[model samples]
Target: MAHLQPKTIVIVGGSLGGLFLGVALKQLRKNLNIRVLERNPTCLLHDQGAGIVAGQDVQEFFQRHDRTHTPLAVTSHQRLYLDRKGNVIDSEDKQQHMTSWDLLYHVLRANFDGVDSEYAKAPEPQDNEGTAVYGYGHQVGDVEIDGAKPLVIHTTTADGNTATFEADLLVGADGPSSTIRKLIDPSVQRTYAGYVAWRGTVPETAVSPAARDVFVEKFPFFHSNGVQILAYTIPGPHGAVAPGTRLLNWVWYVNYAEDSREHVDLMTDKEGTRHHVTLPPGGIQDAVWTHQKEAAQASLPPQFAELVAMTTVPFVQAVTDVISPAAVLGRDARVLLLGDALAGFRPHTAASTNQAALDAMALAEAVGRIVEGEDAAEVLGEWEARVLEYAREGQRRGVEMGQRSQFGVHPLRG
Candidate 1:
């Protein structure tokens, strides 16, 4: 890698996936020019990724690279399953740590920029400063190779002007609606998994005492014939973990046949805007939220229902699955797709972020030889195989887990 190092690298999307790859590459090569482009006007974008289950890959990445690795999660040691009457039907002790999406994003953005400030609330960069730069309010407009010498990344600036950058390498971490993946193979698309998640978070201080008693310090799960719900605790804004300041995060997965009337209705918000990917918070119509709350009362245990009732703004994430035909694109292997851009999984596994971390590490190892013009085809072929296999297994596992929780679940299995 050191021998075949490129002069410049450009990464699209400033979320965890892109930032992690940028950080990983910087760690791998010193004085390597890197730049990250994000569509948000600022690195500060509000989120719906309420909580992340800490995985070893993300944990290790921070340990090895981050200058001031602050503890970033809240831990729970048990899982509780309850009945309609609020009695615990089953419980298991499996210690786990959870973090908020915003906190993780903030830390990574700061680390990528090598900035020491409250902007991302991460430590100052120990060495990197001018080596990498982050551009906000920039949307990637087009990416095409300039005759195979350097890949061109065309972006639309904040004021609607075009800007282009030429890089020896381009990483597409642009998330579920990845422009890079689609550009490489227009036929690839996400397949809806016949369900959607209603996710929300309420502050610990807002939780009723009875609800708090059941949900606090534990991950609670409740299921009826057609629904499954789980709730856990995560730190509040900016990693606030103190008592009464933490958030009680919940995700409720409900099934709806694709192309059914029910599916279309849920996909449309109050303003009649239909979302292709997700219905962001504050977009769910009041009537729809009311109906969901009523459903919660009928399907969930008393404590879980109470938690739902306390939510002021709930959001919906359509569960979907997708895998790219190729991770390395073009004749030269200069274009690459990582994270959600490469493979998107149903959230049932809670491992998408973990997958992103693993993808970054694996791609960093392959890039050196791919760009060196020696073993380009062989190295990229091996890299794509490893990433695709890993993604396929995770996607299938998520679908299996979801099926096991749905209304048609086989009685013999349980």
Candidate 2:
């Protein structure tokens, strides 16, 4: 009898990239063992991320894979630009689609976990000892590369205890404040874009009929004095798609000097905790929300102000950017960074989720070559050359778009 060691992959971060990588890899290579580690205590997270455009990259993947309880997105057939009073300044009949963050996350997670979900397709069986494992309470603490092939990953689990495992490949998909990226190269710090994104969602049944008629099944944009606001409808919690159950999602971006008192004030939560990243929903202080409301009434159109009024808990995400010079880590390239950990683009491009989908899809293809006996180093070279180009260009575009929205030139002005 002969014994064999199955190829193993450990993915850090169980959000979009990590789960997508696990599922894509499993779909591509059946005999491989995959593990995804998420620092979050549980899988049922809310307001961490919100609405996302249903891009071609993600839609392409989902077409071949249906793990969601239902279709992942809602379609909009027009683009409407509104003025301060809610007047339709410009309108176009263009088709688009969008989804809520929770919907995508739940679908990907169910596919990775092979679990029975409310609207999830039952995942394919592992059949053998091979598995697509998810570690919710486990957070990656460190990774050590041995020689060239396998990486030793140390993790701190829920109770402050530690554990270690060996993996043939280590992928860091941990997101914007990526621990893996920092550990790999300290120079790639996030650059705050002198602004923050205020986001919120309103249920279809909660708003007035007139507002619902305008916002439902449409993408709307508004501009005022260097501020940009956009809104679209998406599925409500748990992928609810009935007309009255959908959600109206909106994001408004406003500029502020980085680390200045103004910026600090906005990033501070109700309890005065200065959050390093975003002020999640319900964390806003009364004074801050009041200030924002006053500003909206002064600058935004009446309709937008009304939208803000209907919002129960608007959140804030500091606009920031990070692009790593290298994707493959370690002297021998045993580790790789993907998605936001590699480069976080501004929301302007509406490509963040697609970028992650691209990363997972590309990584899966690279693994296919390795399965055909390609050299690991050679595979890394090919993968990096292709993906970094897309990531860098996408990040550049996002920054450019964000700048235009805030300061470059106002679309409404033109």
- The TM-scores, one per candidate, come to 0.91, 0.94
TM-score of 1: 0.91
Q: Candidate 1: list runs displaced more than 4 Å.
A: 1-4, 115-122, 128-130, 367-382, 410-414
**Residues 1-414 of candidate 2: C-alpha lDDT, one tens digit per residue:** 011122798899888888788888887645888998888887554445389998998998787655443678899989888877788878999888899888887788777776565656666564542578888788787888656446789989888999888888888999988898888888889988888899998887887766775689999888766789988899987788788888999899998887888788888988889986788888998888999988888888676777888788899998999999988887667778999988999999999888888888888888777766777677778888888998999999998888888987776631
Estimate, for each residue in 269-365, the C-alpha lDDT of model 1 and write its tens digit: 8999888678998998787889889988877788888889989988999888788877888656778888888888778788889888888887766
Which residue pairs in model 1 clash with each other?
none
- Where does model 2 exceed 4 Å of error? 1-6, 47-49, 124-129
lDDT scores of the candidates, listed in order: 0.79, 0.82
- State each candidate's clash count: 0, 3
- For candidate 1, the 10 contiguous residues with the lowest summed lDDT are 405-414
Best by TM-score: 2
> Could you give the C-alpha RMSD of every candidate to the true structure, in order shown?
2.8, 2.8
Scored by lDDT, model 1 comes in at 0.79
